[model samples]
Target: MSSAQQEEEVLGKAYDGRLMGRLLAYVRPYRWQVVVATLAAGLHSVTQVVGPYLNKVIIDRYLFPTHAPGSHSLIGNYLPADPWRGIASVALLYITMLVIGFALDFLQTWSMQWVGQHSMYDLRRDLFHHLQRLQISFFDRNPVGRMVTRVTNDVEMINDMISSALVAFFDDSFVLLLIIVVMFRFNWKLSLITLAVLPFMILATRAFRRAVRDSYRRIRVAVARINVFLQEHVTGMSVVQAFNREQRAYDEFDQINRVHLRAWTDAVFAYALYYPAIEFLSTLAIALILWFGGLRVLNHT
Candidate 1:
């Protein structure tokens, strides 16, 4: 493998606190935006939880009207007894929740994106300034394309981590925590049954992460190779043409591109398998809930 490919293939620690601290330095300037975004994400998670609860309210009070003793005291007391009015009221509340969720989602996305772009701009400017001050030996050792990729593609990955991945982590954690609380509050037994599949889900997630990591490494190496090949050949295209090496160059490029294509194919395949596995696990959890909850309902226990 070429030096660029080798560099790309070199694995780093999964989580580097020092590196994260460095990245956080960029975010420190816009800490207030991050705070707003995090709050919005948390509220958005609440909106998600509320939707399902509203569905339950619609079923129990308005549509089905169980009228079970002590059950009609909570949400029912606030709602109109007339079915049509109650349904309309709940529908209005749901729409309002949807609107609030939309606004929160937009605010969170915009704020994070704004922070990411500004942070990356500062990062790239620093990188450019550093590059300008580098010694001549540094330029001789590193391929121009590799250096360009560091400034462009690698920095974009950091931006994605900031804007998308970190945000997702926070948002999903909030959703998960809220869902767990709601689930246990509603029925502890049913919640336990639903969560019985947690171990399997963890295993599947680990396997999926491993597969994706390998595929990503391959993709990075392939991309680095392509960049290096293109930089060298394109810059020396006149000499290649003079030497009648067009066919050879084309074949080499074709091979490099095929590696890139195969890497992407592997990544896609991993994702395809992962989503279905997660779906299966989710279905299993739901099935377990239905089976156990159905028994409870039937037994009036």
Candidate 2:
């Protein structure tokens, strides 16, 4: 059997409190940067609604007669007759918001990435130090290939979660919360109807997460097997030739490669199913909005 077929020792959990606490400990040193990045993400989240809300204000005031005269306005007074100045001012403010959001997004990305890189660097260094302190029997028990994976691929996965996924998680969460706030703020009935699809979406997401996790695990195992097979075969090439085992070695490698291909294909299928599923649900939401929300607009309710 290929090394990739070996049983994995590090099993991941859906929600591991101890694991999360340890991860947070690694991030504690850079808590200030994390805070600033979060604040910037929040600013970007709040600013995201500005353009749409501004459009609503402009349409209600200048384009449509949805409200009475002298209602809420960005300027001193909102006169339906004199909407040009108000419209121009609102547009300018909208443009300003876009600019500010751009700056905030840049800062947020940079700050989080900085924190992530530094934290991962420390983690990688620690991993290397720990490996250096291991006994010779440890080396004899574990293959060189598996040890290499520990210091490289596995560490890279942790780095990705710490540096990219963690920040992205917050960014996405804030965006979702802001979307809920904006949807209800604009139209509660439409929002409720649109959100009716959320429970299904969440369920689909949960299934996708579990499936993807298994697929990814299979992929990692397959990759490790291939790496171990290659490393051992290449190092023992002379012995294989002396024993006329080239054909056998080639066959084994082909088998390992096929297993790797199958593993990655499963991952691809998981991704394919998840994204299109989300898009289908999103389309359903939009269809509901157009059907019901359209009626509300037409009836002027």
Candidate 3:
């Protein structure tokens, strides 16, 4: 493997505070936008939880009305007693929540993307300036493709982290926290039973992360190799043609392209397994909830 490939293959710490701090520095100028995006993400998560809660309320109070007629809570008192009217009101509320969720989602996505683009612009500008000031020996030591990758692909990855990954992390955390609270509030025993599969889920997630990490490293290395190979060969096309090396060059490129294809295939396979594993665990949790909760209901517990 070439030096560039070796460098790309060396995976660093997943979460380095120093690196994160440096990245955040670029985001400092757009702090307000970040705050807005964060808030929007949180609100969107609330909407997600609220949608399910609304469904439960509709079923319990309006559809079935299993509880005593006069025992309705303050919020329930506001709801129409007539089933059809209550359904209409709840349905309207559900639609309103959907619209609000859509707006929040749009705001979060737009603001983060705006921040990401601006941050990347600043980073790329600074990187180019730094490259310009470096000694001639610096250029000699680094391949053009590697430097190009740093300026383009690597910076784009940082943009993606800012625009998608970080926001998603926050949104998911909020959603999970809300779900746990809601679950425990509704039925502590059932919640405990539902969470019993959490350990297995965690283990599966760890394994999935490891597999994906390895695949990502391989993909990065393959990308660098492809860049290096193309830069060298394409630039010397005249020389290659004169020496009748077109077929050889094509064969070499084919090999490098195959490496990239295999790397992507591995990534796809990992994702396929990871999602199904998570879904299976979720199904198991739901099954357990039904079995245990049904017994409680039958026993009038």
Candidate 4:
């Protein structure tokens, strides 16, 4: 990681840890809801595991049964007496899991949002009360727009990631771990091959995240500079026209506009490169899974 990314990581983790500790304290008043939400998340993860297992079972027993040919009633073979029945059962099982997963998803979402927003509302009230406690010099040093961005945009971002994305990420990671365990149980060789690509993908994600974050920060700065320029010009429009300084205003705008354009172009190029690289790597992993697993299945090895 770059030094900038390392610094960001450190700061982010520290802020997140502190905020979450405070947020968790809010659950004392809604302990039952929090418990229910936790259970809902667990159920969602279980559904994720069951969905893939159902697919495996359907493929093995219904779509391409190993013993179907010799399963004649007179042959006394123990293969499914009616493969269609098995398929129907699997279909029902899948649908049931889907419904359960969706319901749990909704419950988790609603509960987490309620808890998060409630805590944030209380926190904002406190912040406002504290803001009243600050001296006038604090207001003088911090621009109103900048302070608003911190209290509004920055706080909202924190709420979004912590309340929603954080829980969802935890649920996803649990599901992912369960999937890996089951996948390896199904076929360890294929699991190993598929997992070998994971590290590279994670590294690429980290690199792309840093690049995109820095690029977008630059874009925002450029946009802000342009806005400041426009604000000044518009505020002084009458004086400019009276002094016949239209040419000077145009020149200033052109310079700011060029900066904005460069910022946008650089951001676009960065994203273009980042997305295609990730897509290429993901595609390569899928192809390898198909090719290698197909061979292994055919060889019964």
- Provide the lDDT at 232 for model 1: 95
The model with the greater lDDT, 2 or 3, is 3
Model 4, 156-260: lDDT tens digits are: 755786578867876887788888887776668878888887888788878777776666666555554555466567778999999999998899889868876
Report the number of the highest-TM-score candidate.
1
lDDT of 1 by residue, 119-190 (tens): 999999999999999999989988888888889888998999899997899889999999999888777888
Q: TM-scores for all candidates?
A: 0.95, 0.90, 0.94, 0.74
The model with the greater TM-score, 1 or 4, is 1
- Evaluate all candidate structures by whole-model CA lDDT and list the values in order: 0.88, 0.81, 0.88, 0.71
Ranking by TM-score: 1, 3, 2, 4
Clashes of each: 0, 2, 0, 0
Candidate 2 residue pairs that clash: 3-225, 4-225
Q: After superposition, which runs of candidate 3 have C-alpha atoms over 4 Å from their true positions?
A: 1-3, 68-74
lDDT of 2 by residue, 1-301 (tens): 4333345625478889998898788889999999999999998988886777788778877777455443354543543357787788888888999999999999998988898788878877888899899899877767777767777787778778866887788888898898898778666888999999999999999998888888778778767777778878999999999999999999999997998788788889989998999999999999999999789668966
* Local distance difference test, candidate 3: 0.88
